[model samples]
Target: MAEQKNRFPLKRREFVKIAVSFLPAAFLLPATARAMALVRSPVRVNRLRPPGAVPEEIFAGKCIRCGRCVEVCPYRSIELLDIRAGVFAGTPIIRAEEIPCYLCMKCTQVCPTGTLQKISQEKTRMGLAVVNRHLCYTWQSMTICRTCFDVCPFKEKAITLDQLRPVIMEEYCVGCGICSHACPVTAADGMKAVTIEPIYSWE
Candidate 1:
């Protein structure tokens, strides 16, 4: 009993020494640590869909973050953007380089979750691509840059040229973002020809 009691003090001393040794590590680690930290990152989803369009609910609910949609996209329109709003980490964002979604529905086909469903290209209305008239060179009464109109895969309906400039028919426009990526002024002026917005039900 006495020996055990004596060993208790020694054990306590050993534990204290070990703990003290780790103190410097704790302090040093902070100094040497990089910017990486487990922060509560935000997830942004359904930004590509119309306001009420909830994609999270549409896809099988549990969408494993895989690059399937990005890989299958022929137009290279689908990309993974950093999570900024909800619970998701990195999710897909469409960038239209004047080649908006022709309603290919390929992304949906690749998506494991009903998140991206295999809907007909004709029926798919992901979102509407809005154009900023002021930033558009043609729309702003500048040189005729019909790049967006020319590149759009949608036949006669998606994008229409008026007065030598392009106008997006909200009903026909899908938030593909091809025009945004294809815009020549994007790099210099930081303006995109197309942007995604929630689907609106006027009725």
Candidate 2:
């Protein structure tokens, strides 16, 4: 009788262990497959766009997903979301928090299509990076350094000199990434750079 009782418990435990192991796969597989399908299918028809002022027409019409943009991005902000859907299955997606774009224009420079567009620093408008006067060392009555303005390719334009201090012109800011890359304050307090959000959707 004792042997049988112990055997019963052992059988029950074995069943429970088996059930527990397979349960997770049952739930996870469907979700993982769906996500994979969404990324792999060409004509995504549900891809979410990046946030901020990116050119929708250019992104939709030109991006070829050659990985050049992601490869050249110094900050590694651009990444391939998936290889399932959208214009380019393995195209780059901007991950602002992990590695925000610095507007270096290297991606645009390497893009084979006009997706990234080719504009001189004088006419570059890849979104502007504005200084939070409250956060800026120069505006906060601290040291004086215009690293962002000096590094900007736009000559006396995109980021201009106001009394030898950097000032952003909203109309001219195109969210490129140059100022973000050159900002000396980025490593200190996550300041000096932020990408405009909610512009695109690759659902």
Candidate 3:
């Protein structure tokens, strides 16, 4: 009984030593985390919406971020905006380089709210595909690549080749983003030669 009692005080002293060892780490943990967070870069999002999505002002107000649009996307093209997006946080965005919307029309059908109205392919009007002639292989006559024309859902009306130069018919193009995704050249800025621009933009 006396030996056991002697051991108890020794164990208590060991526990106090271990606890003291952690004191410095505990004090530094918060400061280390804050420093790491400060060094981290912010996420950049496309200020654009999916097909059949409402206007930018209305979209910011209506989208509930239920992730239904993200879930139903067949091409896995949809992504939820980060908290860094400010007023547009949790909204659906599509980065064409990652995976562009193929216009299957499934996301619109699954939206519980009318934020994304179920519209037919012909009426999607998500955004227009703009080709940077300087970056296009066909425009430079470097290669006979008809990637954009072959992939367009509305090739006859929205896109046509004149001497192998693909032209985007703005009025007919629904801005589905398939052309941009199919483009071969990815610029240094991480953008494709052909890109989908919001239907309404500063340009």
Candidate 4:
């Protein structure tokens, strides 16, 4: 037993040196937390808040995470953010590519916290749809595809045709994402020719 103990020398000293090396990191933890709290996550394409949602700056604080909006969605469009979303965890989000908001306006009525304010279907502005001309078949003159314009809820008001190619009108667009979901031309990255971008709904 005594001989076995001698196999390791200066074990306590080595541990102490390693412990001191991590001290600086420990002190930085508080500052890192503060910085993270101050910085809001950047708005991602295709991921959007439900219609009538307040601005991003105050959304996290105002939301109560009741899951009411998710329960009332007829199309199962709204989903709560998971813990990985940091401070915004449990807030409602719509992944437009997977299931576009049908604009039934049911979610806005069920939000007890006013996180999603009650609004008419025509007034909903989730995000703006931007078209990637490079990936569009109609734009490239490869084919005459009218899938986006046909699928749009607002029809000619939101999306019009110029020489058989789709043109997105920004002012009349409510960003329901139906056009993005129905787009047939998909790139290697899984992005459709049209995709929704954050347009600050309150604006």
Candidate 5:
């Protein structure tokens, strides 16, 4: 009975310690929020731009918020940004999971503003596809899967198998989002084994 009484105080003390430890984090939360707000950081980490987009600098200045690109897209892959996008508001974006661009290149034709440039499917550079080896069946040697390779528009050119495992040839990848939407792993695990990476450019 005496020991049981003593145990209560120790548990109380540990609880107090944990509560005190959270004080620093609580204080830092406001500063972190402010930093992010100031930066106006893009919400999409792998935010794939519309097909045939020019360099970020040139595209930003040229895009006139015309919704023609959004209307012409058959797959509904392109979406215009809302007010929350800061200076990039009204720019078109493609979230690969929702709808991958079919590489039809129709969006460019209707653009009154030259934000989405006129480029061939073969020359378009939306982004790259990187395989998550940890989640990939081929790299884990658990099973042979080639969904990404099979769906690639530039199959032999962009993706090929080495030792019966998939390899993404970055140079040839158009970042069209086909492999990202077609990935079999995302269906089973809710995590994409192959996903699109937005094209990054220098300022």
Candidate 6:
């Protein structure tokens, strides 16, 4: 009985030491998991959700992945993400460069869940369009390229000519990605001079 009692204290000490070693990792585990989730998530630049999408944080949980948005899109702009998208798999995504969202507002109307709230095309803020002056022919004085300006749905409101170079107006730009697809100048990396960025993705 005495021998067992003596060993109990030693076992307790070993357990305490082991638990202490894991304490720091326990504190860091949640943060590490969150960081890993962000890395593996489908959210990224140029990839837009259907118009009137809710914030990305709640999007996965709220979205039932029924593909209603994909089916209702008359322009065939929305596509379901494959299994490689991690938790966001089966969720609808718009690859503007390939098939830009036409802002027909059809997808928003078909969503069974509020993940894609119905809103006006003019009010939908899917993302923002950024102009890379270095790659832009008009900005760099290479050629008079007004393709982006001409293709923009908002035209004079979203994009305007400044000294004949296309300038993006953030407040009015809807990030529809039409300009990105229409831009004639393609960088060596295959990116357009004007690209839509997921500026409003997180929130």
Please tell me which predicted candidate would have the highest TM-score against the true structure: 6
Q: All candidates: CA RMSD in angstroms?
A: 11.5, 9.2, 12.4, 8.1, 6.8, 7.5
Candidates' C-alpha lDDT: 0.57, 0.56, 0.78, 0.86, 0.79, 0.88
Better of 1 and 6 by lDDT: 6
Please, what are the lDDT tens digits per residue for candidate 3 over residues 1-203?
89898768667788999999999999899978766654332222323467788766577668788999999888888888776556666888887667777888888898888888888989877777788999998999999898999999998789999898989998888877788878889889878888877754212
| Candidate 1: segments with Cα more than 4 A from true spot | 1-60, 74-76, 81-86, 96-104, 187-189, 198-203
Comparing 5 and 6 by lDDT, which wins?
A: 6
Task: Using TM-score as the measure, name the better of candidate 2 and candidate 3.
Answer: 3
Q: Give me candidate 5's TM-score against the actual structure.
A: 0.76
lDDT of 4 by residue, 82-142 (tens): 7767778888999888899999899888888887898888777889999999999999989
lDDT of predicted model 1: 0.57
Deviation in Å, model 2, residue 195 alpha carbon:
5.9
Model 1 agreement with the true structure over 2-26: per-residue lDDT tens digits: 9898768667788899999999999
- Write down the worst ten-residue block by lDDT for model 2: 44-53
From the highest TM-score down, the ranking of the candidates is: 6, 4, 5, 3, 1, 2
Over the stretch 1-203, how does candidate 6's per-residue lDDT look in tens digits?
Answer: 89998768567788899999999999899978876764465756678898899998889889999998888889899999887677888999998888898899988888999899988878888889999999999999988989989989999999999989999999998889999889888899888898998888887
Question: Where is model 4 more than 4 Å wrong at Cα?
Answer: 1-39
In model 6, which residue pairs have backbone atoms overlapping below 3 Å?
A: none
Q: Can you rank all candidates by lDDT, best first?
A: 6, 4, 5, 3, 1, 2
Cα lDDT tens digits for candidate 2, 1-203: 89898768667788899999999999999989877765442321112222231365446456665777777778777777564453445656653334455556677677777666665544444334556676666766677878777765554766787877778766565544555556666525454543332322221
Where is model 2 more than 4 Å wrong at Cα? Answer: 1-54, 57-64, 68-78, 82-89, 94-114, 117-122, 171-174, 187-189, 193-203
Which lDDT value does model 4 have at 72?
91
Give stretches of model 6 more than 4 Å off: 1-39
lDDT of 5 at 123: 83
1-203 in candidate 5: lDDT tens per residue?
89997777667788889999999989999978766664453424347778778777666578888789999998888888887666677888888866888889999898887777799998888888888888888888989989888988899889899998888898898888788788777636465888777644322
**Model number with the top lDDT:** 6
